[model samples]
Target: MATPGTAKRMWALDSPTFTVDKSLLLLGASGECTIPMPAFLIEHPKGLVLFDTGLVPAAATDPEGVYGPLAEHLGLSFLPEQTVDAQLEALGYKLSDIKYVIASHTHFDHTGGLYLFPDAQFYVGEGDMRFGFWPDPAGAGFFRQADIEPLRGRNVLEVPGVDHDVFGDGSVVILFTPGHTPGELSLLVRLPGRNFILTGDTVHLRDALTTIAPMPHDADTVQSLRSIRRLNLLRDSADATIWISHDPEDWAEFKHAPNCFE
Candidate 1:
């Protein structure tokens, strides 16, 4: 592995396929749509890092347990191999090797594999830790107690709503782009040549940002719109490619693990 500053290899891991109402992804859109959940592996010289964990292993055999009724509602699909452990094994790595696990939010899809990396230093946005713990009961359905239980007293870093340089080098950064959730965090990766921005539900589909429409699941639509504007500015200023994690187009454009972005 190269040093933090020199670390450049990154792999994108896809979870089992999921289908959702297109309108749920982008307001005003209709029809059923399929999307892939993605997790990223970055081999930094300082330590191996994983960004977001796809669905839990149980999603394959016991979706009701992992996702409750939402599993069927979202049409969640899972294959045994889509588990983080399986994906890491296929990539020649183990959960024990991961030094840091940066979570975008506490959504089941993103935090499913969190418990599997108990040894890794966990990180989530500032307000989200508490929000996940005691979210508004009215809409707390999204915050599963099971997902929040594993993070009880672990080594979790609550990243402030600002740009956090993971390795103290600008190579990899956590961007605070809250909207979809109280403290949703996006990612900025500066590679040797091209730069990229990982939009974690901040902008679910291209149309959401392009049309200035926020998804229905957002905690704050106004704030979501503002966040999208911020992302747009960041994209234009840095000339970074915005990779919407759930966008089918992006899933097709980016290669899965074994194939990576260097």
Candidate 2:
């Protein structure tokens, strides 16, 4: 924690690279394409806040160890330096500095590094916990047992639909934007120059937001559309930027850690 009025600094962390079906990003699409798995480091005045954890480190050396066959199916790949610890170290920080972790959802890619931060307060949406405890088989192998196990009985804050104000400063707020998963969450971060809304799979790409194309893995198509519309309204109302989590185009426009948004 810095000071009460002190503004927070945000850094976009490096993530694993993977390819997925075009239709998986935008419905009714064909073929495959590359995407980035991003994590964020927020130097809040109260404490360090991390948004999502990207991929598991084991996936770097042994993809099969972390994700089983799904790792191969998605063509997941990464270097050891891209792991969360390495990314933090590259930014002149360490895993111990993180005070709170905001998980967008329980999907393998987003929650992979949670095991590394047991002492950090974990924030997640209420409904998503069920998926973590007993993942529905119909999710098409999106949620993983190994990833969810680490978060079982820790200091978990199950944020309800009302949304959560991370530091009570209205700077870094967790918005409950479901549909990608039962309790999918997004972020509303107020930086010095710009306000950013990190949409965690709430419409995998910007095109899906414009086209209102429901992703194939979306838990509820109608709810997904509503969430996208809600984000669009918020984006327009505040003139904020929406960063789609898995969109490579969005990822390309930012600087990975060691550089930051203040």
Candidate 3:
């Protein structure tokens, strides 16, 4: 394999959406905002990998049923065809073709398609699954029981709170930048022409990159800030583009599936 940044490698799955207050995406911001929830698929030379599954397929018709009160609050706009499995099939791949599932974290948005990959190897940060089950407190609503329940008998390979090179060639990496959730993670993909740091809720909007701020609900504000700073350093030093996954602005910037990153 000569390397594939030229083409035929990675693609962005179409996004579903959920509307929330601007304040939800960034600290001290306001107004209602609709954001994109994108998923990614990578056809690595060695194997197939997926990053961040969007909303539950059921959410398209029954958001309230799938997500409870939170769905009503967030206002979902998902299409049945926007699901991971459907998108993969559209692209001529199958559910079983995904050899690896790299979950940026177990937030409901990122874990929706995990059930499709029970036979594939799973990768997540150390505290993520644990946090998904225990959560922060008496009623932390982000962790959905349905999302975590399916992992019971699956193969999950947790990376101890640190950065990891997924393929050993430095093409894909898992950066441990927890804050939004206890084991929140971000992905770093080094395509031949460009590099991308997929910020998985580490900083929900591009504004956070400039302000260096953490959203109000993060598990550790201090750690969140530090992670932002680290990402900034990486952005500058490596000339990497930080793709804020939920940023609507970002959704417009990249081409959806059928179109690809590299």
Q: Candidate 2 or 3, higher lDDT?
A: 2
What's the distance in Å from true for residue 241, model 2? 0.7
Q: Which stretches of candidate 1 lie over 4 Å from their true place?
A: 1-6
**Candidates' TM-scores?**
0.94, 0.95, 0.94
Report the lDDT tens digits of candidate 1 across residue range 1-262. 5443535788888577779888877888998889888898887778888889878777788998767788888888788887888889998887799999989998777888899988899889989978888887655777776876898889999998787999887778899988888889998887765678898888888888788888877887888999899999999976789999999998888777878877
Q: Report the Cα lDDT for candidate 1.
A: 0.84
Can you rank all candidates by lDDT, best first? Answer: 2, 1, 3
User: lDDT tens digits, residues 1-262, model 3?
Assistant: 5542321367889878888998877898998888988888877787888988777777877888888888877887888888888899999998999988888888888888888888998888878888888888732777786986888978988989899888787788889998887788888887767788888889998899999989887888998999999999988865788899999888898787988777
**For candidate 3, which ten residues in a row score worst on lDDT?**
1-10
Count of clashes, each model: 1, 0, 0
Q: Give the TM-score of candidate 2.
A: 0.95
Candidate 2 C-alpha lDDT tens digits along 73-132: 888879999998889888887788989999999988888899999899999987997876
Worst 10 residues of 2 by lDDT: 1-10
Better of 1 and 2 by TM-score: 2
Q: What is the C-alpha RMSD of each candidate to the true structure, in Å?
A: 2.7, 2.7, 2.4
Query: In model 1, what are the clashing residue pairs, if there are any?
Result: 2-45
